[model samples]
Target: MEVMQYAEDALTINLGNEVDEKINRQLVILKAAIEKLEIEGITDIVLSYTSLIVYFDVQKTNIEKLKESLSTLDLSDLTDSTYSYKVIKIPVCYGGKFGPDLDSFKADGLEPEDVIARHSEKEYLVYMLGFMPGFPFLGGLDESLYKARLDSPRTKIPAGSVGIGGQQTGMYPFDSPGGWNLLGRTPIPLYDSSRESAILYEAGDRIIYTSIDEDEYYRIQEAYEKGQYTVDIEYRGEENGA
Candidate 1:
């Protein structure tokens, strides 16, 4: 790991140079450790695929002391230990009006059912959240389904619309202009300011997609809007004897 000063009140630690699950896991462990410390002046901890950016208050802490504290940490235990994570099951309505770009994949020689099956069969990892509020950047997409972004971005992508851009797959949390290949949509509200906690998922969380019909989609949407529906989730503990 390499630590370098980022600004007057922030430092960035480069955990690895490439994006990999092991590297990301290390960064998560480190971020958790720093948060547990509750170090004075440390205001925020931002994590990327292979790095952690720590922001601090100059008035409360200095670089030397912070570096010293970080150097004393032993990350071996964290590296060896298994971590418990939440798995979220998201319902999606693929093809037709919900996914305008579905035919684009068909032209590429992929059947709609094949596309949906490939996408929903695997569990994905929430690598980070960016591009827009509550937007999750998920990893673990099947390479066979990889596709390029549109030549021109759409003026607006509806909230909850799921899409693929190159190797990445994610959903739009709000209506915004985007160029990802539209695959499906979910009814769950990813972001809502009225809730005590707005965003539903966080980095390190796992996600699984389930295909639903248009009628069921609208039903869930209505139930969700009425505050009667909750996204399905499973809590998995670390492996035994880890």
Candidate 2:
């Protein structure tokens, strides 16, 4: 691992240059260790696919002090899977208007069902949540389903729109301009400012997508709006031996 001054009030600790499970797990460990210290002036620890940015306040702590604190941390056994994760099952309705670019898979000799089957067949690791509020950057897209992004990006991608951009796949939590090819959409709200818990999933979590028909999509959407929908989740906590 390598550490460098990111800015006047931030530092970046790089775990690895490439994106891998071990690197991401190490990032989790590094962030947890920093938080455990509860050091003064550390305002926020922003994690990404390969590194973490520690934001600090000069009033409480200086760059030199924060760097010294980080040096004393125990970042050993980074490859050890000491952290736990919860699997969130998201229901999606693929193809048609929900995924106008669903046909883009055909260029790779894949049907929309083929794309759905491959895309939803595995659990995706939540690398980081960025690009927009509550928008998760998920890893583990099947190589066969990879497709280049659209030449002309859309100005307003619909909320809940699941899309694939180059090597990554994610959903839009709001109507935002994006270039990812739409694959489908989920009915559940990923981000709701009015809710007590704004975002349901975090960086360390894993999520699986299951194909749902249009009818079930509307049903779940309505249920969520009426405060009746609950996402299916399975926890594998380390402390509880789950």
Candidate 3:
């Protein structure tokens, strides 16, 4: 890991070269250090897919103090209590109205079952939350299922739609326009502005998708809309990316 001090109030830490679950786990380290300083002014702390960017107020905290604070941060020392990450199992229904790109994906040398099997076989890590509120940027897709995004992005992708664009896969949390090739739809409502924690998944959590039929999806959808259902969660250990 390499740490670079920028200007008088910013420090950038490089964990590695790529974005994945492994990199996302490093957020715990940053949160732990910041909590210790109890600094009066923290402008912003942004965690990208692979690096940690911390912005502080020069008026309240100096570069030397910031550097000293970062030096005490040991990635391995972060307590499990300091970070709250959970593994969530998202139930999705694939094919037919849910996945219009089914046949197209099959043509990419993948059978419909092969597609589902490949997608659900491993637990993915939530690398970051972006694109839309509560929508997680997940890592851990079976390379066999890799496919490019549609040449033309859909004018409107329904909320709860699951998609694969490039080497990654993600879920749509709101009814937004997007370009990812749609593969399925989940009944889970991932974001609710009224709730205290509007976003269901955050960076560093694990995610798994379980296949469900149309009938189950409808039942869950109705219950979810009423705020009576809770999404199921499943956990799996970390694996090194090849």
Query: What tens digits encode model 2's per-residue C-alpha lDDT throughout 118-208?
Result: 9995899899999888899999999887778889999999999998988889999999999999999999888987777688787878989
Ranking by lDDT: 2, 1, 3
Candidate 3, 144-227: lDDT as tens digits: 877898898899999989999888999899898888878899987788777766776767788989898999999999998898
Candidate number with the higher TM-score (1 or 3): 1
The lDDT of model 2 is: 0.86
TM-score of each: 0.94, 0.93, 0.82
Better of 2 and 3 by TM-score: 2
Pairs of residues clashing in candidate 1: none
lDDT of 1 by residue, 49-123 (tens): 888899999999999989988887677666766676689899999989898887787777888888998999579
User: What is the lDDT of every predicted structure here?
Assistant: 0.86, 0.86, 0.78
- State the displacement of the C-alpha of residue 222, model 2, in Å, after optimal TM-score superposition: 0.9
Give the range of the ten consecutive residues with the poorest summed lDDT in model 2.
233-242
Query: How does model 3 fare in lDDT?
Result: 0.78
Candidate 2 vs candidate 3, lDDT winner: 2
Model 3, stretches more than 4 Å misplaced? 1-11, 56-65, 76-84, 234-242
